[model samples]
Target: MTTTPGDKFSYKIELHIHLDGAIRSETILDISKTKGRPIISVDDDGQETVITDQESLDKEIVITTPCSLKLFLHAFNVFMPIIAGDRDAVFRIAYEFCEDCAKSGIRYVEARYNPHLLANTLDKPAYARERGDFSPRDVVITVCDALDKGSRDFNITVNSILCCMTHQPDWSAEIVSLCKEFKDRGVVAIDSAGQDFEPGKDPLLCGHKKAFKEAYDNGIHRTVHAGENGPSEGVREALDHMYAERIGHGYHVTDDPELYSRCKEDGVHFEICPLSSIITGACPEDIMKHPLIRFADEGVNFSLNTDDPIILNNALADDYVLANKMGLSDEQIINSIFNAARASFATEEQKKKMLQDLVNVYGEH
Candidate 1:
């Protein structure tokens, strides 16, 4: 196919990837064995008996959804214990994550994770001594340092965002403070992640209002996990309550034309993760039927991403390819790429430079 001037392929950016869920499967297994943790079984018979439903599972093992969220969360349980007490483990994970993104041809990527979850893994003795030392602040710092080092080492640029689990809104104050503390260290935004189906466990509960206010007040960028497992209300809450500049998995907005129009008008970028959505049962069985295309047709500002690459077994290119196969035209693909670049938390100057780079690579005027 003779590509048009505007069809020339160029820059790609993934703004909604999850850090912990992006860890390599083999790497998780290695960490699990090293920590003497029993591996969750997924045998040939498919009789793997991990927690399929959060309601049915023991409280100790937090399983959220049977389809997608359950699997994603279970995957985390396998690795969290292994990497918790060790600083080097956290560093290695961040390093490897960047390496994976670079290998996948992601020039600039923003990976988000809940630092509190990782902080809960501090060395038992160290944590015990302090009694009140349950903090992932150091892990956040070390991981950022490792990411920066890896970025320099691998010739790829990666930024980290500390995600707040919305189930715990009180932690927002601390997370926002951490974002400010590490603003210069590559911690750019705050995110709320986890199963979105729980009643009253909304982004607002996670200090979305306060966090966004703080981020704006501090001149930091803001993003939120919205519209994944809930209705249009969740999407509206993310915008009205949190003032999120970018939305993670805002797929449900498709159900509400008004909100979709609002998103389009306000230029709130939706970080759509195809594989994750499919695997999590958030999307229909067919990729072509995904509402993202409809939203794209409506000119909603959005971009493709791999929310949990490891769990979904996907990458940035995979998403692009999927979109293409699902009938996205070359122009739409290029536009989505530009949308991502523009929606990125990078500064205006950076966005301009990236857009120019895209035009140069794709020959798009």
Candidate 2:
């Protein structure tokens, strides 16, 4: 078991956590039971297992070993349908996510998700679900409402980012619109997430490029999932074409010396998820050789994050633990926390307060 970083630092800031991937297993089980939906788990041998209890369900959804990105994402297929398309489930998850973050000593967090994935009204639902009246617009409204209340009730500053699935470039326009529509209502940014780019393929799809350009023109904050499973060029593409202010799991940026130098010189904020990197096979299994070590050595502007806590079966503290084990000093960890606060999409006033709070606890870095 990993030690909880909260024991040492009570105030933490997280920049890259997924709202959908951080749902509680207990909540998933409860939703499945209430909906009378049978939980199915498929094995590597092509065998299907029925998950009836929390134990079985956890075993099915939580990944303990390193796996391909394809296998890691399969965990979502097991339970997303149980919660998606259900208004109460969506609201409850957002609220409970705040509570969980508070429990983990996270003072401020920016959660991200694809609004359409939770909306059943899509002509082709993200998952296999019947059509309904709950539009993607409705999803953003519900999420913003729940996050606002949760932020107040839990005493944590929580904002959300609407994601454009990489494969669904057509959805990008609507996603950017939702980001604008809900900018004051808790939505802070737009992110491009979904499948990784195949080798030698252009990382920035044309539609995504146009939408991100629009987001840029409209003053919407932008982040993109690049260079995690894709090559270093993907990171360059995100910076050049998408106006990405921050990068998600941009480990491979180190692969290109010129690009890496540019990112370092430009102070691009990299949201690095240490455990997620290993589990998703974005980095090698060897912890010591992790790009994070190089990032620390090079003084890269980056922050540690829990990319998918449910699938990784970890909390924010767990990521801190892994970073510590990987040779990050206490000072380095604290620096990352401060980096997150500075790079956050929060308003300047809020960011100032958060930084002051950190200084009060950490005593001038």
Candidate 3:
């Protein structure tokens, strides 16, 4: 009658969420205090950076309006530094993320972020050489080790997705090598995220070409950020050039019928973060206008995610509820969750156990 023989169905899977942006607001304040760093630092221009308001940090961290993705990304800079300078900060925030997920009943999550970005404190020798936090490889391992510990402690799974920015082609090889070295320690897949296209640049990069090829050759699963800020062509490039098994926020694919058909036929999955799409203006805040419903109508496989839950002020449960408001039935919403687990980079044996646990809890929707 049941599969996994446990109450694992109380667990859920979230395939896409940014590690840096998803840290709790209260945790940011806690870390800032622990590190003795100013919650408010500034740029060269002297604009006060991060949260200055000691009185209302929670009120301030949550962005409550819609804007372009570029502006939407600025929120990350404020709190990223809190975790960047110290290894302990990384461990605490990452562990807390898993702990939060466990409390929320999220069994597994694929957390993604640029390893280089997290190592910003290590970027300048003048600023970092003395403190000695300056190794990207070490930074990545610190984060992964914390996640592994969290997984064991929380009895929840936290998989890492190392994101390579498309513009910064130089970092690709190093990231792939890091994944290769740390795959056993919960580094499951590779991703290319941020700034899909610029005025003079292609969304797809040659460096990723080499890196993803190596990942493919090694049988590592990969995904790319596309069709959210960029055009549908970027989605095609991800599917064709990088051999991406999943497309991140590919909202614009609905603009092209032929490409939509191709993706559905290929069984390629989309990690759709609805509220993030709304906040970034990729889709309207009004669910009725979103192309997601159309994409679903055409049999496109997809999974709902929070993208950056703390940044978006949403969660996996919130996403499913939003899909219901978007006119998808309860069955469809649950199926999307199932799709998330199926599309995960976890091994087949792991998946089987997870699916059985899930079905025992959820009863195959």
Candidate 4:
């Protein structure tokens, strides 16, 4: 079991937590029962099987073995019942996410998820035909407000990255417009994630480069989930075609010497989530031989994150312990923390404060 990091590393940062995937287990149960939704689970065979009861609900929440990405995604079915277009549930989850991060000593975190997924519930006949004043834009507003509230109420900083799923419609322009509308609020970046392999999505994304251009032209940072489930070429496409500023789980950059060198030259940071990689079958080996050491050794700029804390039953402190488990030294972990701060989307002032706090805690590592 991974324990929390020791006292030397006092300040923590989370750059890649998914909002829905990180929802509290208690909240999941409450939403499932309250909404009369079926408690669901995906067995090792990647089949959609019911959770049966509370014991299964508890078990399915965390994965102990390598699982299919398709099956892993099915686990999200439980949350769709709650987060799909319900403003109260949206605000509550957003608030609780930041609050929980604060309690974990995460001073600054970037919460990410496909806004389109959250909008799935809103698109239903009941929400559209019955409610006249509502639109998807309002969902964006509510979530941003909740993040702001979480920052205020919990005294921790929270920010969001809107996602554009490659397989789905490219609402990239609409998402960009929403980010611009609330840029002064908590919304910060735009991301390309999900179903990266299929050719249908790639051409669709290629055709919608205007949306990416819109975000880039409007000054929103871009990140893409590449090299996780797909080959390293996805990482190349993310950088060359999509104008990505950073690459999520770009571990496969190492698969190609040129790509690794290109990212190195560009200073594109990798958002590495060790436990998520292991749980989702992205990494065939456990933490010990994970690409973290290789990436660090090769001078690849990267940051450790709790991609889905609730999903993997992992924590940011546990991430530090994980680094140790990977046989990384305390000095390397400290250096990586500073590296993450440098690569973060946080403002310079926030980054300065973070480093200042780090200095006070670890004292010139």
lDDT for residue 335 in candidate 1, whole number 0-100:
84
In the predicted model 3, the residue pairs found to clash are: none
CA shift of 239, model 3, Å? 0.8
Instruction: Decide which is better by TM-score, 2 or 4.
Output: 2
For each candidate, the alpha-carbon lDDT, in order, equals 0.71, 0.89, 0.78, 0.74
Off by over 4 Å in 3: 1-9, 41-46, 49-55, 120-131, 198-204
Candidate no. 4 TM-score: 0.89
Please give the ranking of all candidate structures by TM-score, highest first, separated by commas.
2, 3, 4, 1
Q: Alpha carbon lDDT of residue 232, candidate 4?
A: 86
Q: List the residue pairs that clash in candidate 2.
A: none
TM-score, model 2 to reference: 0.96
Compose the digit string of candidate 4's lDDT tens values, residues 156-194.
888888887666554666777877887777678888776
Tens digits of per-residue lDDT, candidate 3, 217-253, equal 9977899999997789888888888889999999998
By summed lDDT, which 10 consecutive residues of candidate 3 come out lowest? 1-10
Judged by lDDT relative to the true structure, which candidate is superior, 3 or 4? 3
Q: Give the TM-score of candidate 1.
A: 0.84
lDDT, residue 203, model 2: 50
- Global Cα lDDT for candidate 3: 0.78
Ranking by lDDT: 2, 3, 4, 1
Clashing pairs in 4: none
